[model samples]
Target: MATFNVRPDIDAAVAKLSSTVGTKREIQHLPEVLWEGETVEMLATGVYGKGNGLLVMTNQRLVFYFHGVMSQKVEDFPYRSVSSVQWSGGMLMGTLTVFASGNKAEIKQVPKDQGKALADLLRQRISEATSAPTQAAPAAAPAGDIASRLATLDQLRAAGAITDEEYRDRRTKILDSL
Candidate 1:
């Protein structure tokens, strides 16, 4: 991969998107987010115009963004979901190919250094994702939630916000719901 001067056009596009894009920090703590535990590792600017795109590598996924002044599209491939990742072409431009969930996505005409860096970062993340214990969330979530609820109920009862009978009823309901 050859490192080229980042053109003013690429920098300008990146600057515009940075403020508008939703980042890992903004979504990681969301309870309903599926690709949980993701954090941005790197981001790179791509070609401009309707074909303008962003390459974002996260701890849990590789994300591609296609944007124009009028519209935008974002695609995510979780490291676990990816079957293979490959790249080709020369120093001036290249393509990134990712096979995931039985489908393939190719990001074309990206600068060589950006594409190679993205590929290297993705390979590292994929290896980590594969070795890590899979989502243990389901096993621990209910126990943690129930314990917290029990504590809150105890606090409410002590504060006289709820009668003992009411506290007991709510606590039992919370336990049963779990």
Candidate 2:
């Protein structure tokens, strides 16, 4: 396995690669965006290595974005301070070596097959994290026409006339019929 130290001239390589592929390449230098009083900056930009995959970096992390039919955060992994790297089955896998305060840690890439599983797991975690406890909402009085029905549903949900589940199911059925 060969690990190429990324040089400052990475932009030149990106240009040449884009030219060879006959596609326009866009390199976005992430600007510092203030979110909730925290300054966020993208440490790495554009695609690199053999495949032109998306690369993202933050202040202390580097992430390689890979494709997965299922959305998963594990689909992306850190690539900085990598001690070993290998390409396998059309995917890049490696062990990242990180050092802080003279201490080291190893992080391995999630296997391709496991990537899907990892994605599913992450999806579940996120779903659980974001899910609020269901509360009963008031039922909406029947309104005339689809527009009125939707408005009634919205009003009912807002006014605690129906539960969230009821609102969602009724909305889906109404939309489907239309």
Candidate 3:
């Protein structure tokens, strides 16, 4: 997986999307709608309601944006607001459904190969956002302890205790607090 910066990096976002499976037509509108500091993690082409759009999973939110000849629609669901996400793929297409605040948003016709990955990433983001910190700041563990802590984290990944994405996120947090 590509590393998405926590800070807004339009060039990186564009480059990442270009390599992913999706339509580039809507990429032009991203700069205008993306929130400051948001990072795009995944993108898929799908249909939301009656409009064809791009479903974007970002560091902070899930967004669906469509620009047509007559109208434009942009819908964003913050990670914290997302209660659950599910993905189902058929032979040629997939569906992604997001449940948030008693509302449900479903995007259909997602690229089959991209659906599960996007859903899993969204679930990971939601879990990270909703889970309360269970311990005191590792930043307080002494400057000399940082290296050892990172090593332990890496070992946990190697041992299959945490996913690669989780390791990267935790590592980034540890480094950023430095």
- TM-score for each predicted model, relative to the true structure: 0.51, 0.26, 0.64
Off by over 4 Å in 2: 1-51, 55-114, 139-149, 152-168, 172-178
Residues 3-61 of candidate 1 have per-residue lDDT tens digits of 22243333333443323233323222222232555555666555433455667666667
lDDT scores for all predictions? 0.61, 0.38, 0.76
Higher-TM-score candidate of 2 and 3: 3
**Over 4 Å off in model 1, which ranges?**
1-38, 47-50, 133-178
lDDT of 2 at 59: 32
Candidate 3: where are CA atoms >4 Å away?
Answer: 1-22, 134-178
Per-residue CA lDDT of model 2 for 17-46, tens digit only, reads 312221122132222111232222232222
Worst ten in a row by lDDT for model 3: 1-10
Rank order by TM-score, top first? 3, 1, 2
Better of 1 and 2 by TM-score: 1
